[model samples]
Target: MTSTSDLWTIRPAQARDTDILADIYLRVRRTTFLWVDPGKFHSEDFVGQTPGERVFVCEDRNGTIAGFMTLWEPDDFIHMLYILPEFQGRGAGKALLAALPEWPNRRYRLKCLVKNTRAIAFYRSLGFAIIGDGSSPEGDYKDMQLSGN
Candidate 1:
């Protein structure tokens, strides 16, 4: 597998990418949510929500799907971000984030599992601040937001 920092392109997802994206989503979720119910992966719910948001995919030089993210542009909410385990820490997440269309005076917000310290740290490094906390069927989570500035 290529490093996430290696040459990769970000593009709008297409119907053809459904399976690949699903696989990445499941794999990443299972790995990250071990503290929760692994059997409740909810792969369908994850894939089903893609159509409602702006989905972007990160592809490697070989055209392999490495990761993906979903953004609700209207609300400036980052719905999901998942990178294959092999591709994590390779800058794929950062690249996917960079691909989000920029808007003036728009703050972005997202909820991340509280147990996902690495992801929380990553978001914090990108200037996101913890604003609150919440709970879901999966587990406890922290609300994080990034300033428009």
Candidate 2:
């Protein structure tokens, strides 16, 4: 499905968009996950990790891809949502979330690294609450969930 929010256009990931999306994935992770070893994240990791998951990409008014999100349908898990640093704070993440099928009527869950306070706050603003906490190889994390409307 296609969705538009302000100047951002959100749509399903097309085959042609994979390379750019993977690059964004690598770049965002390297920059955002500062506590993790940057070398551990590779562009190909996006391709490998996203199989069987539904993926979507958001583009700016000029048609440049600015971010992407991935969802594991079976469990309603928001596996990843990343926007290019240059395009952040424009509601691309929220647009991507809304583009999900049956959004706001379907529960969602995601793990946010405890150190990423900005992300935690963002999620909280979207109505996600920390339901549990745990540690990952990168650092401690909080398991957050948002109930359906």
Candidate 3:
């Protein structure tokens, strides 16, 4: 599905977008996950995480990519959502989430690292609630779910 707003255009990711997407993924993870070893993140990690997932890219009015989100549709799981630091509060992330094909009508799930308070707050503001908690190699994370209203 594709969606456009004054600030962002969200569309299905294309093969040509992979490189920039990977770069954003690597950079965002390294900076956002301060508790993790930044050295362990690589562009290849984006490739590995995205296979079999439905991916979408968010671009600005200038056509510059601001972020991307990957969804495991079968489970309504939002596997990843990362906006560049510069684009974080400009509604790119919200646009990407709304672009989901089943958005607002189906439940969605995602895990946010507990220490990533900023992200957790963002999710919470969108009606997500912690359903569980677990530890991953990166750190402890909260399993959050946003149910259809």
In terms of TM-score, the best-performing candidate is 3
Off by over 4 Å in 1: 1-6, 103-105
Task: Tell me the spans in candidate 3 whose CA falls farther than 4 Å from its real position.
Answer: none
Report, for every candidate in turn, its global Cα lDDT versus the true structure.
Answer: 0.83, 0.92, 0.93
Write candidate 2's Cα lDDT for 32-77 as tens digits: 9998999999889999999999999999999999999999999999
How would you encode candidate 3's per-residue C-alpha lDDT over 24-133 as one tens digit per residue?
99999999998889999998999998899999999999999999999999899999999999999999999999898767777899999999999999999998989999
TM-score of 1: 0.90
Which sequence of candidate numbers ranks them by TM-score, best first? Answer: 3, 2, 1
Which 10 consecutive residues of model 2 have the lowest summed lDDT? 98-107
Ten-residue segment with the worst summed lDDT in candidate 3? Answer: 98-107
At residue 107, candidate 3 shows an lDDT of: 86
Candidate 3: the clashing residue pairs are none
Task: Rate residue 108 of model 3 by lDDT.
Answer: 94
lDDT-based ranking: 3, 2, 1
